[model samples]
Target: MHPSAFLRLAALLALSLPAHAQEGMKQQPAASDRVKEVPSIEAVGLSGLKPGTILFTDHRDDPAKPENGLVPYLDWGRVRPAERAALAPYAGYAEPDYLQTLNGVSKRRHETLKVYVAQGRFVVPRPADSIDLASYATLGFVAKMDPVIKHKTLNPADVTPTKDPAAAFAKRPDRPWCDLGTVCIESRYDLEGKLPLGVKLANKLEDGASKKVAEFVSFQSELRTLPPAETAPLAGLTKIDAPVTGGLEQTIFWVNQILRFGKFLAVFQPMPGDPAKTVVTTYMALAIKADVLDRKQEYARVPVLKNLLPAQVLMGNSSFNTGTSISAGLPTYARNRMTAFADALAKN
Candidate 1:
């Protein structure tokens, strides 16, 4: 299948499924499971919401309490059989192996969440297309060096338009794995013994004749190293031996992704309280993908089971259902992340 087609399918999976549907598809948890289930909110369906009005809600999971965090939302069983068949020949689709390693990050989880809006108005520093949205230092994640991966855009001279799907897919010169029309980021903390966690942000905005709509979606997942005792699952299966080499520090894998377009957009409007300043109200969807395990020994043994497994599961009970406090900080953190973006836009 064409890479673009794959992306389209991913987007479709992200948008079409409801929150309950997403939760239902996960590997069923045991009766003793205590993972907290949080409600999902929709920014677009809020009452009195107009076409351009931005509504925000920070539905988040606490990182400090890794145990209570949400599990992954996507699984192969949820996918249509035809769709799975089409992707079966791809690198990660057929079975669990090293080929699933796209770039440096593992493509193990296919989780997604809906976009929610947060309160505030932001100024678009420059044209959306011109801004370096993925500059980590500029966004306050990393300093000096640009940690965000950069991909070469398809040179018009290199691409040949064709009616044939196979020819078109093969000739497409654009970075096939890059998120085509969205801004995406993946970040892991530098320090060791720090939960092996990562934050993934992927968002998109659509412009209508008179108004523009934007969706901000994020996924937080755990990236744990497999324990020596967990070799039972790897017994018959071919383990991709392509592990990163180097010292302990060198062996640490960092998250990376190609950022496409910026999802941040601002519109001027007068409202109660702050009428003069540009209050950046962004639609943010902060999702903690549910990571659950039924029996003690299930570790994604098959393609279907792999979808049910997430790295967080390896952390044991600590990474299960979250408490109220974990989600309590979501609204503030969501606002803070977007605030940094707005501030950067102001300086730009």
Candidate 2:
């Protein structure tokens, strides 16, 4: 299974554990441990990020030169006005159309997309005394972004937008179904007269395929339709509760067919020696399954005339073979997002 799917399954399983078992799970290393300890921007071969400026670049000062590579860093409030303006549109969060653009790039099999990762950091100016996580949350920054962070169902057109120059491709989806996060799991739906959405969706795919293939597609289809709150086994959730916590790890699940399983994370850490300043980093990890061509050779010569076969016959199937290519661009997307977030934060 892909890592994202595995994590989703694990989360579901953990939610069903008894209270004592849940407590034991919490005792283990916090999920925050997964956050990489990036060096301060100064030590990473870069300097002079203005106190409130936000910059986005690879961990390396120069991607082509390893000797001058810089490690990831998350600190300081040095974003510039121009930069902030550039990222403002992205600051609103969950731009499904923008995500579709990245997904579109990955779908181009002829492009030979390779594994990619990018890391960046930014600083948000804080009141002089409000530096800790608690203070930051109390200030309403988290609340302002809460709804924006959740997964939103987008129109299929957003994924493959029309070419009309006058079209409005940026309009938000109406009545987007919440698929993940606290808002989704906590919301009460009026299902009184409606069939269970999951079963209704499953029955739609039960036709027109061999048993094995039908079962596979059906299962995936169901996952895309069911709310993560319903499919995931998480317990102890209340309608009034906000799943977010300062300095805690949270996940937003993507439940689209083209992109079967993926995880998006955003973390906020306090800057050292500056309690009022906070460093926020966002991470995205995606797993896609697709088919690609691989070069291979297979003998086309018949047994009786093998020795007499022409070169072309002997080289049949040598040109290319079909195989799977799983590319990861989530990290790059996350880095781009952080750059924008920093800029937007600076302006705000």
How many backbone clashes does every candidate have? 28, 12
TM-score of each: 0.27, 0.31
Misplaced by over 4 Å in model 2 are 1-49, 52-116, 127-181, 185-254, 257-260, 290-332
By summed lDDT, the worst window of 10 consecutive residues in model 1 runs over 245-254
Give the per-residue lDDT of model 2 (tens digit) for 149-240: 32333333332212232223323244232323222221111111111221122223233322211111110100122133331221111111
How many clashes (backbone atoms < 3 Å, residues ≥3 apart in a chain or on different chains) does model 2 have?
Answer: 12
Ten-residue region with minimum lDDT total, candidate 2: 214-223
Say which candidate scores most in lDDT: 2
Give the Cα-based TM-score of candidate 1 against the true structure. 0.27
In model 1, what lDDT does residue 335 have? 46
What does candidate 1's lDDT look like per residue over 1-348, in tens digits?
355644564455435444543343322233211111223322232233332233343233553332333222233325323222211222232211122344566554432322122333333323333443334222233211122212222323322222234223222243332123322233332211111111111111111213211121221111112233332232112111221111000010111211111122222222223233232233322222222223223323322222223323222222221222111133333344444545455665
